[model samples]
Target: MSDATQNDERSQGVSRRGFVAGTGAVLGAAAIGGLGLPAQASAAEAATAASIDNGARVPVLIIGTGYGGSVTALRLAQAGVDVHMVEMGMAWDTPGSDGKIFAHTTKPDGRSFWLRTKTKQPLSNFLGFPIDQDIPKYTGILDAEEFSGITVYQGRGVGGGSLVNGGMAVTPKRENFSSVLPSVDVDEMYNTYYPRANAGLGVTNVDQRWWESANCYQYARVGRKHAERSGFPFVFVPNVYDWEYMKAEEAGTVPKSAVAGEILYGNNYGKKSLQKTYIAQAKATGKVTISTLHKVTSVSPAASGGGYTVAIDQINTSGDTVATKTVTADRVFFAAGSVGTTKLLVRLKATGALPNLSSEVGKGWGENGNVMCGRANHMWDATGKVQSSIPTAGIDNWAAGGAFAEVAPLPTGIETYASFYLSITKNPHRAEFTYNAATGKVDLNWQTAWKQDSINMAKSIFDKINKKEGTIYRTDLFGTYKIWGDHLTYHPLGGVVLNKATDNYGRLNGYQGLYVMDGSLIPGNATVNPFVTITALAERNIDKIITADLGR
Candidate 1:
């Protein structure tokens, strides 16, 4: 099959059955997530065969299918707008030879890292030995994008970061909301958008009673014990994982996902990713279409037309560009997460494609004050061998220590006597993405030394815990004798910040129909897991944009 046809099929095939079963002719929201095979597969295929033909114009074009993109597409499609979303990754709908769509965390293959020859596991070492191994370069799920100083780990697929994240859907505390997005109306978000985003994303808390005794959560319990002993609050954070399904997995009544250590790359089941929530609903609207493996390379104003001309490159599994296509859109939404959107916008401004874009486009980028470390739990406090990858609780030291650390799992399939944590601190350093004209690429000026602030902030929490527990830090997780994992960030925020690079409602300052509706809008930190904020802010921005801009 032609690449365009394959891209179109992968984009719509998984949800086609659900769509057909709901509305007969088009997809419907209630049935698109996991409906069985379409009653009329051939007809559904024919109906969705309208691939990205060159020169075709769409009502709206969205770049990326992450949380922001998914939310924007769903809402716009509901408002009778035809949206074409272009994603730079695979559909991830087809199972591999192992009869699984996603590879397990411990046994990663070509299905793990995006276009890389070697696996870049966040935990680079184990038991004083390097764990990364060579693999065939493929368009995999996780993209450990390297810059000057940091490796930003982002998810690449039709569902975007939702495919690989731990599903820790945390809304910032009401009082801290002002610092997260100062320009936004506090009451509107707290009372309306946050709840809408949480409900739409299927966020729920784990049964605390069950968590107290679950074997898989022994790691979290150890973490809680240490935090409580250190006088820090141990809080249960809500996640997008289906708690009941996880209970069934523990009971051996269903196929295991979280309990089987199915995170990092992707979760095969139970986790409510965008594909199972927003993207599914968008496809069900019958007004939204997608093209996978099609990366947007340029977005310039059309010489003759009123909308923007988007140039896309269709790539293969080996990351080779086979075809380039150009299409026009009446409006465009930059929902490519923080790193992707920032890089694109920065490059566009420098290369003269969108020269009118303000300098603020590339400023105010941050790593969300992310730092990771592991604790050496005493032999008496053994974290279980069979651990759940879906994290459910965290240590809240944000008030005193400037850190909120999630009790992450070390699912090495063995009792490692380790308590892992990913801490989001209150580091105030902001970086910038600059265009490297010499290299014809974008570079982030985020120095490795800048992470010292984050390390110091994180130390405020772990130091007290280690002292209270009379334990030392684990040195084998990140590297040999390395105490802090400060070289990477899973949460990349800002660049095209709200009310800075764009108007109050995400409309680009100089471009009328161009907008940013992603993590790029948040100025650096969300004080918790950023996806819930990304989804909620997108919900708020798109609602205002549609009402004022779209002639609905």
Candidate 2:
């Protein structure tokens, strides 16, 4: 066998078929205390739900149980208004028959994707060998939704993107913040809402001494070493993971998760997703209820009424509609992430449900300039055998070239001298979503070549580091080993943009009491992990909404 092939065998501990066959447990690894565990909460158990098809009228109806929806639910419930939440995906609290709460990133099954027979993994290959396998179609955690030229990976569950992210609670720099959301009050966000949101989410930092010696973060240390060698400022990025728990994990006193290279799917331990944060508080209010497996198919003006009417489909495990329900609400909030919210609004407006919708309804959409690239490191710059899935640092080159590249974790357990990064650059290309009644779908007019701008911006840092270290880019990651995977985005933002599409406080223009409280409101991008900004913006908007608009 070739040296590379031998290395693959040694690193993976099995061949492709062998790894595929051994799936009795989570990721083929024996339960090491805390890996692929901490069952996700079922929607039914997470919050109370009113029976569908019963014609219940709510004061406020929030669609999707994500950051925006959950935050709205909490704030509105705090204001003593009864709220009803609709989520198209399943609740993530329960574990499967395998006695595990989630599937491992390496060994994905029915729990990997949203309605697909084969898994569409972000990390599709290892050592030039394709690692993706067939999975029984089920509503999985990660939804790698594809368009013509790009694949957007979004989470499908109660907590939304928070369920399937790296738990990086990042806020954009103040200098770049105005461009992210110019209409909003900057002082209110940074001084008030950002702090409130971060505190609510339990955002924390890693211990520096522990970070330097922790086995899980050795890959990061190697990255720091190189970034310092190249004279670029390397900085630590805060996370939502519990650092104390991570320390306990490494000490072997607690179950190993981030240390066991568990991320990208979900971390059953040490990581605090929205379920354990906002949604938990929202549930505590007891005024908010969530209905899972219920997809909002149609929304329109109430027949001879003053409120909005919504048509919801209650689907079974097979995605077949078992029942249809209708809800009438005085106010409606769209918290269905960027794609979900935009698709619904675009379809509704185009189909005459809300004809007076602004021309900006489906405009100003972007992928946040996301690009993934890896470099082959020399033996002296070994990235480490054990890599933490949660990245805590990045190459700070945004000042020089408007790119903030996170030194991401490979998390494959067995490392092969490689350094990877997922860069968020300021690529100023925005697309518009057009509704095609023929296909009954929303189409975004974005070209794959649009990513080249981001790639060039990201290369500003990598090219410098490469020249400094005399290394090269990896060829196996995005199709052809050396070529960057420049066509996919984990962060999808904007469609029903803020200020233009909605009033200053997220009230849909020309349609009062119709609000949008999600990442869809951002003009195009957040220039960071969109969740924190999405959360903060939701706070900023809802606080004003509750004070200025509601309780009137």
Candidate 3:
């Protein structure tokens, strides 16, 4: 490995100037190739969907412009088929009141945040509203009334969860993938879809020089030393951010900062949200059309050949009156993440709007047993900013017959001294979501049956970290140890799952034209970031649909 690569492995923080200078040195050759495609496309050009067949209307209408939705749109458009996408959030533009292009934290004032207000009885914010409000609205998936105490951050702009999620791009361990998708050939899927998705999204490891100065790296080093002392191995994580930008930060060409630490809030810089990736490429195809701020209310069986008619409520940007529009499509793909897809399908099933819905519309929910842990160091060294770079290492104990654990650097900002942290503890948790018949809302009732496994995993990893001779500081227990039935990371999976609700290929089990391609199609928690999996599955499903022997 090069010095920069060695530095990254060692967990060194890089300055912004160092980052930029390193990027210029390393990326100059690669940038000369096709790297200019994304930059050549303006923000507007990147966000707009490409045009499909001009002679005929599209055969498919994808709802939501998220990871799954955008991927499906891109594949279909590439196949020369017409595709239209409807999104409930606004297009990503200049930063609004916050002075940032994206938002990571919720504003106290309701003006900037998104809330759920779709029902007569106004829901509370804890259930999942960005801001507390009494008005009836569709506040993403969480029950705003019940989750009032929790901060459930769901992105409402063009890219959906991709805009707000940590850019951690990890493939699930082989066992996890096999358990959830036993029928599909895991090796084939990985070989085919994994590289395709990564290429499309620009996945790369953090430049070593950047990690040389990053606070996250310092923390990782601490964790690694502790793990070594405890006989545990240190693992590096791969992410979906522009490593070039990271190098720029290290070289001081760019600001020694990130889109901002509220990664789950939103990244104004550094991170590559879907809006900047698949969505951007799909728009470049000139065949997809995306209508933002338009929410789909219902879908019904069209009188035509196994098609469907979608009812959407278009929210006026300037006024209160909502206009409804009915659009027809030969196929409808639901790629609105896990919660959004499940809620939509559940509501439709309950209301008899799409009576042919299968019995397994809403069930088998899992959270990939997500737990965030960290260790605090006593030293007061000025490590580089944490948010500007991504984690470069991970632990594979969980994947290799050992407890599931992955450690990475946590960006706690400068000045505050801290060591490495891990979003570790990767045992798949079994949870279920129930639709309340009386209220027409989905309630997530999670039980901690896998508590022992999770605790064991944490203890083993912590012990390993502590045993490392080079370790600094003790592993300090921080947030989210209680494992309450609280809302955690937004990587929700299952519910409207595959094989059961849909056919082996994601076609609705009973309905002819209905399809689902979002995280919901994932049979279980990924134990890693879910976006790449979701996108790859979307591609796989679209390919199966287009190649089917069924006459078009």
- Name the candidate that leads on TM-score: 2
Instruction: Write model 3 residue lDDT over 99-195, tens digit each, in one string.
Output: 5444233221121245433211111121121122232222221222233222234567678877756678877766668776776778777889877
Instruction: Give RMSD to native, each candidate.
Output: 12.5, 4.6, 10.2
Candidate 2 clashes: the total is 12
Measured on C-alpha atoms, candidate 1 has an lDDT of 0.86
Work out the TM-score per prediction.
0.91, 0.92, 0.76
Q: Candidate 2 at 188: error in angstroms? A: 1.6
- On lDDT, the leading prediction is 1
* Model 3 spans > 4 angstroms off: 1-58, 97-99, 104-113, 116-153, 213-216, 256-262, 303-306, 316-321, 380-389, 399-414, 419-428, 448-453, 463-487, 549-552
Write model 2 residue lDDT over 286-380, tens digit each, in one string: 88878887889877778856788988988754467768888788888999999999989999989998898899998999999899998777655
lDDT of each: 0.86, 0.81, 0.59
Q: How would you order the candidates by lDDT, starting with the best? A: 1, 2, 3
Which 10-residue window in model 1 sums to the lowest lDDT?
25-34
Question: lDDT (0-100) at residue 424 of candidate 3?
Answer: 40
Clashing residue pairs found in predicted model 1: 19-27
True lDDT of residue 309, candidate 2: 90
For model 2, the superposed segments whose C-alpha errors exceed 4 Å read: 1-51
